[model samples]
Target: MNKFLLTFKDSKIEKDYQENKLNTLQKPIFYWLLVMSFTLNLLKVILDYTYYTVNNQSWMNVGFVILVILELFLACYKKQYIKYALIISNLSAGLLQINFDESNTFPQEYYSYGSYYAMLSVVVYFMTDFPYSVFQVFIHLSMKIFFTTIKSHRIDMLGIILGLITNVFLVLTLYICDWNSRRQFLLNLREVRWEESLPFIIKKPFYLFTYKDKNMSFQVNRAYNQDFFPYYNQEDCCGCNFRQFLRKCKVENNNLEIYLFDKRNEKLDFDLVYQNKTHKFDIRVCAIGLDQINYLIILEKLKLLTTSYIPKQTNLRQKIFQIKKTQIKYQHQKHFLLGVFSMFLYNNKEITSINLVDVLQKFSSRYFIISKSKIHIVYSDRSIYQLITYKHQLIIYLIQLFDCLINNQADPHSGIKLLLNQGLYAIRLKIYLTNRLKFQEQYKDNFFIQEIERNILSEEIDERLEISFLKKVRSAETSI
Candidate 1:
């Protein structure tokens, strides 16, 4: 019941119609209004010349002719404000012409009263806004009643009752029907817009988009916001629209809409000009979970990054990632052991995550890896260049710390010192031990000769692998 009484239940829908639909429908509605008013005036001219012309209303007929010509001129006018002013004036004049006449011609008879109904129907159709249309009608209806009482010097109850009933039925039916139709159209349009956007949103672009973080490195669309987009295409454009940002940054390589996706941990500069003002943004590509990544775009005004951020960002990134030293010491009375072994492997053999187990297999003894880092190495009292220590002895010492308390030693936490390094976890430690896999009896000259033989053998393997030009290129850079 409330929905019918009020054409639109939501104020947002009314706002949408005004903001979106009004400009689109403006010219067409104006043209239609012009045609209808022209036709009605033409019909009135024929009636006046053929039938009878009232002596008192002669000035009104001449005024109607001038107004019709003005309406025709307004139909060609481009400005909406001018066209609207003309429409309101014309409607007001038509209402006054009907009201200030003799009782038989306009107030009581079917012919003049029929024109009254025609005028109202045009008002309802032209001004589809329910509340405004009803407001206009209320003012007109009250004015007509006041005119009737003034002319007859009495209140005509029957006539007012008839006028009220006709108005209620006419305004409600036409306005509600029109609003409902437009409402459904808007709803269908919204659904279609979602369906169109689904393809781009399938990827992880929209969710993690933010601006102005130093750690932003997800993607760089070919040249983001290199072109100017027009402002008044109903576009309330903002940087928050991640999919639109991606689309705007798109370029066509060999196929359709290809975007540059950079997975490095870095910040990308994205510039956009909106509403005649330039905006500088910083975007960070960071991982949301293990599987998906988010791009953060921060506005420069909010975050306050200077112009020299680009050159200094490298040094800044290094500072962010610079490993801080962490020291941890544990002492146990239980006999703790430490050992270091100097192993000579083939020079060309590189230990990596993929071939770790495989390369360890190449060694003569079973060398279990505690851990290793590309930028970090271990140091011990005996030897380095593959140092073996209690660092790999996880299984033996796993439960010994807590179990020492159960054994009730005098000071289980005192003698044996456990070493720790924050840069390389549980790996780099200082300890005293005898070196294994090294013959102490052998002279230093003998150990040097063994290292030379391993180097020559590894070089021979490399020569065998690089047989052709294609093989050399492929081996030099696997990514190429």
Candidate 2:
């Protein structure tokens, strides 16, 4: 008998589905429901005082006050325990109301006045998983029916049927809604994961599309910013979309041959000044293709390219020599093309942004040079690259410390543009590490190498990777 019971319990459908459903529900949504339930119940009890006799008045008031206090405590101190706590408390209050209704000689409409809290409970817990919600409502209804029939020594078949119909209808409706919501949540989660992984595959924030015919439509249109170039005025552009703009441009520019046939197996860079009679803006277009149909499109604003900050040089020859000297001595950088990105194979290991204050604090305790050195890190999308050169004195030990702030690039120009707009002069370098496979494949079997990669690139940069990179520099200085 015990084995049969255990098997029955284990066979329950959608077990722990509430756990996933709760994860999708925002904390604000949880709090809003809690507040609404309490406020409505309090108002219901006060306004419908005729339902409660003088004998039961104190008990009902005391029970409600206690429930509210418990809810408030759960909201503040015991949030994790809310799912179980709330279900038990609500079920208890509902049973108490039914027990009181049994003593009355008059017709007891518990479903309308006393046990309507059960319906409210169902609505509140609907945000949880469906099965758990149905189970709670079933328990509440069963207790009400059992207690009422047992006390009165009679059963109302019509009343029982009505109660079942109302509560069961609510349960089924809520379950369907919850199921639909959970499905949509999962889809959105998958979409976000795809967006994050796309950059690792493409390297550049350029769009790729396939054209099977002279119509030249997109098979895959994934760009970092969907609004890279505006085709319509915000006020008058009610139905303007990227696809519509591309089709209109094909007709206006009459460049179907240039877009499809001429740019095959080659890269084409040109300036396109698009004018719609009312407005005009210059766009720099870069196109690269593998065959006639498949191609990559890179678009940038002409104003951005022309008005970009260019460092003033006293001597062009001397500056070039200095830059070369710095690159050979300090940079030793590896450039990765967006062309080589593969979802399974490619990984970027470059660290980009670092806090100036934190870097200074860590450096103060370290034993290293305070001499001026040129530190360059480049971050680019497709057309323009942001080059950040730090001329400040940097300690050697603090090299890998910046890895903690290195995030994979998503936007084409925002990070560098923000830095430029803010008038920041000393710090600028955007880097993407395109060789994470080195940490996985090259050193997968080597525990020592794996440790070195994790230490250098993880949340806190491992001191060992920084020391290893600078080992040659230290050795050369000692030899001299």
Candidate 3:
């Protein structure tokens, strides 16, 4: 009981929990209370009418009947205005029963309408919060005292004592109900927060939940759960035991990378292997700081070298050709940028001996279509030109060759300009950049892609594309 009362001492937590409980239970409570109010008040009106008719009495019975009828209508018809309905129904019922009692008697409990106030007190406590229920109890108690004094033409000690006992019971019951509601709310708080934060939970594969402490070496008491690990309850620990790992690795911060060579049974003592012929992984660790000592660690496994599994039936030519075809096909499938560049001799009126197929095969190793104006290249998964040094240099050479054609009175339509225009180049760049940004953002979890992105790009391509595309357009316009 003392513990329960202590909960109310922290008014903020109590109020917060109370409001949460009310929000969760309000709809069901609303319906239940409405039904009870309608049934009870309807009975009250009927009883009052029958009594009045039998006795051939008037004022007090008529008033009680009218008030009960109002309560019934409020409960039935004015349901949407529930707060007002609850207040009016509870208040009106208690007041009418007290003021308009049939017996002109001291101590209203002995009268016909005595039990009505006590019943209404129960309803008030259940359907509303403590303060409001307490308010109603006080009002009912005060009215009972006032009425008893007036009826006896003196202060009735017995009636006052009974009212005080009833109010005490009501108050205690209200507190207990509220305390239970708060306890239930606290029990479901974690689940409620988790449900509300689905987006955060879905993205975070490994969640490190810990409690911060003042006495410990680390500010947090590390509570490890295996559920977040990829292979939960498996033989491979995957370095999940952070407490042990921290001691062995001599870690300063949350970021720690340790490579373990799994040799099926035996442990390697040297930790060094020649010619990259070992089962080794470059593990990258990135920690996201959540609190003082509580953090989320993202572990990435990268295989530097591995033995290739080859088919026994397939020869070297078949394997080489298959790999080449797969690379080209993948490039074609994920093509994000397409550029057209044509080549022609400086003094030639027309292409007499320039075989398009030969040029594409000899100069650019990538598959391309030879149009009348230029050789078209599609940058699918990446800039294939950037991968081959000669290919990049060859493109520059071809552009220069075409420029020489312009100087040598060659056809105006036979160059890079004929293949692509300024506006078209800008639009294509935008489309390419947008698609590439979207693609990178999609598969950024892959280790190889992250490595490539980190090494090859100065700034984030997506950021550059979005931020500097306009500047590129301006430069393109100026060049044009």
Give the Cα lDDT of each candidate. Answer: 0.38, 0.42, 0.40
TM-score of 1: 0.34
Cα lDDT tens digits for candidate 1, 263-318: 32343334432211112323332333222323433222212112322224444335
- Give one digit per residue, the lDDT tens place, for model 3 in 328-387: 422322221121111111111121222222333343233222213332333332322122
The 10 consecutive residues of candidate 2 with the worst lDDT sum are 471-480
Q: Which candidate is the best by TM-score?
A: 2
Task: Work out candidate 1's RMSD over C-alphas.
Answer: 23.6
lDDT: worst 10-residue window of model 3? 467-476
Looking at model 2, the pairs that clash are 347-434, 347-436, 348-433, 348-434, 349-433, 350-433, 378-430, 388-428, 388-429, 455-462
Give lDDT tens digits, candidate 2, residues 1-480.
Answer: 022111113322233334454455534555665676567557656745755554544456556656767777876785566666556655666655543434553555654665466555765556555566677778877886887688768997887898899887887686667656655555555555655675675443344555545654444445543333434222223223444445545523565334544455466566666543222334444554333334445443312121122223334335334434554322211111111111111122233434433444343223122222222222233223222211111222233222211222233132211111111112222223333333223233432222232212211212222111210111101110
Global lDDT for candidate 2? 0.42
lDDT rank, highest first? 2, 3, 1
Cα RMSD, each candidate: 23.6, 20.1, 17.2
- In candidate 2, residue 224 scores what lDDT? 46
lDDT of 1: 0.38
- Candidate 3 residue 341 Cα shift, in angstroms, is 30
